[model samples]
Target: MRCFEHPSQKRLLRFISPIACLISFMVTDLVTAEEAWLTRSQQLLNTLQGQAKPAWLENNPHQLEARQQVLELFNTSKPLTDLKFGTEQSPMGKNGQPLKMLFISFSLGETTLKGIFEEASGRDDVLLVFRGPKPSQKLPALMGDLKRLLKGIDPVPNIVIDPTRFQRWSVASVPDIVVEQDRKSRLHVRGVSSLSWLDEQIKAGKQGDLGTLGDVGEIAEIDLLEEIKRRMAAIDWKQKQQQAIARFWAQQKFEDLPTAQADRDRSVDLTITAPRDLSAPNGQRIIRAGQTVNPLDKMPFGLCLMVFDATVPAQVELIQHHSCQDKKARVLYLASSMPRQDGWDSLKRLETTLQAPVYLLTPDVRIRFQLQHVPAIVEQVGKHLVVHERKVRASQGAPS
Candidate 1:
């Protein structure tokens, strides 16, 4: 708005001012749009992404997106295959023509989802996208499907995209198939369709070819304990011991079951130590000690005695027959690796008051002999030794 002395100056200012204002406005709008897109994409990304989970997810990752994906997978009406999907920004494979991947995105009630996954599991080439709210009980089911998908694509690349974290398509119907050729662009197809029918559409160019799709197949249940033992047979005793401990929780039935807050608060701080595998072969195959083997050659009895019971009675019987030289009633208990002397004193006081014979063993002796825990006290009770309790302190006993 400077007073132009010359006519040329005045003419130049009139043309330049409007152009500058227009450029500034456009720049501002462009920035706003980019910010909004970034925010949205980030939220979507959180839902679909999980880096390699540790051997456990005992503490639920509080990320909202992760929780939603888990819930969605749980409730789908068709068996949901978690597609190893990605956009150009994030893809399943590098360098090859991306697999023609199809994912269906829909929001159905819990009943609908449970029905869908049960139905859709057998289909080929169709994966389901699950989006829901909060903590989910469907993690095990989703993990089961993931395991199956992983098996078909063996030797998985180190950096494959986690389908659990991304939003690729938007569908307008219940039980729909969301298809994507490029991560950036997606389509929703309405209907209840079989896996074969869906695959046919992908071939027909009804869906874009994204180059990498997860296998739509049933996941096999892995006996992790057996797998670990097989892998450890050639390794050293130390490794075998370590592997046993490492794989113990995974072998347990209660590993990932959800708990109410009150239930979680009341959970015992009990530690499970890896016990020795001492099943000896009978004729063709090795038989577990103490009990007859099953038709599948599984050690049902040995597992009960060794794993569940911790060999207390068996050990006491062995001691009585070999070391005790008399029939006696005895109780045995083992303490934790890290001792709580206060617990020992309590137990000792109980023994004094109750008039019970008790004993203790150091961790070195326990490990050398491949025992579960320490401060083990065994009593002869009519030719049997039962592990009364583990990691119990003398102090933990009722005042005798």
Candidate 2:
């Protein structure tokens, strides 16, 4: 028996048939393309394996020569001078007192450095020594480590790197606190110790005797009668001098002063129109449209102000792009507000990279320009200033 198909079923079949055929054709084409690609890849790999390898790839003469030169340079380095004890005049006190020298090494840990710093705090009499060269590459790292260790109380110990001083003290190892009162007397304390302990050892040494005081009886007495006679002679001379001065003033005639001249051009005062206040409650300021500023008759050339939030990384990239675009313009980078240490660090890095000066947005500039959002560029156009605020996209690497 013959069956009639529904019109809806016919339409469904018509749609499904083409889609199924297209998918089947796509799968067959994909499988054929993949097989061809695999065959080509295998042939290329086999050809590469059969080829001879380069001799330089196994043994590079240029790389070996560079390594040999580096080794030779390192071997030729100068040897450090041997450490020994010597006497030097102390810079801390007067009367040629010998300084108590304490030699230290930078290799010491932060905890030991901190302990030594606490011991030497408020005591300028003792000398802290460093054996290494002054202002070395490693010195800044050492200083940073010390700063982190001694939080709040920034105690910069007096560090001496004089080879002569280090040798005179005979510093063998790190954390050696040596107290030298004189050439003959020296107390060496190895490792980290308290300042009070060093001070006690210094006090235990023999004290020098105080010298004889001057006698008051040796002073000569002043003569009162001779002093009175000298005063009377001076008073008589002053009266004669005053009488001669009065006669000299009476002989001279007084002349009238010359009248000052006034120019008509500068007589009229130049009036300056007050700027409109557009500061919002949320610390944002919006300048009104068609508002013209008439502070000066003519606007200065090539003055551009770039305002941005330094905390935003995307805004930083935008500022860098604009800086490169406007080479002739005097671009001043102003942040929305003053940033903390980390923000300031990022701002400083941006400044160094862009080679431009970055300043915090003051209240005066905020109100005057009426800046609302940042990543904004303000520049002088004809008689008025034009402000352009650019939209910043959220960066994937930026902190939430």
Best by lDDT: 2
Tens digit per residue, CA lDDT, model 1, 250-343? 4422111111112111111111221322322333323223433211111101101111112223333322222222233122222121113333
Query: What local lDDT score does residue 60 receive in model 2, on the 0 to 100 scale?
Result: 36
Best by TM-score: 2
Q: On a 0 to 100 scale, what is the lDDT of residue 257 in model 2?
A: 16
RMSD of every candidate to native, in Å, equals 31.6, 37.0
Which portions of model 1 miss their true places by more than 4 Å? 1-125, 132-168, 171-173, 182-187, 207-400
What value of lDDT does candidate 2 attain over all alpha carbons? 0.45
Quantify all predictions' global Cα lDDT against the true fold: 0.31, 0.45
Candidate 2: tens digits of C-alpha lDDT, residues 1-400:
1123333224323423322233233223222332332343233334433343322222233334445533432322111111111122223533446455555554554566567766655455766655432232343353455456545443344444444454565544555555545463355655534567556656887233212222111101112223334444444333443343343234422121111122111111112332554444465543333444343233232447777766666767776776423455566666664344344345447667767556555544554555666767776555456666666555423322
Q: Among all windows of ten consecutive residues in candidate 1, which has the lowest summed lDDT?
A: 299-308
lDDT at 67 for candidate 2?
53
TM-score of 1: 0.21
lDDT score, candidate 2, position 168: 61
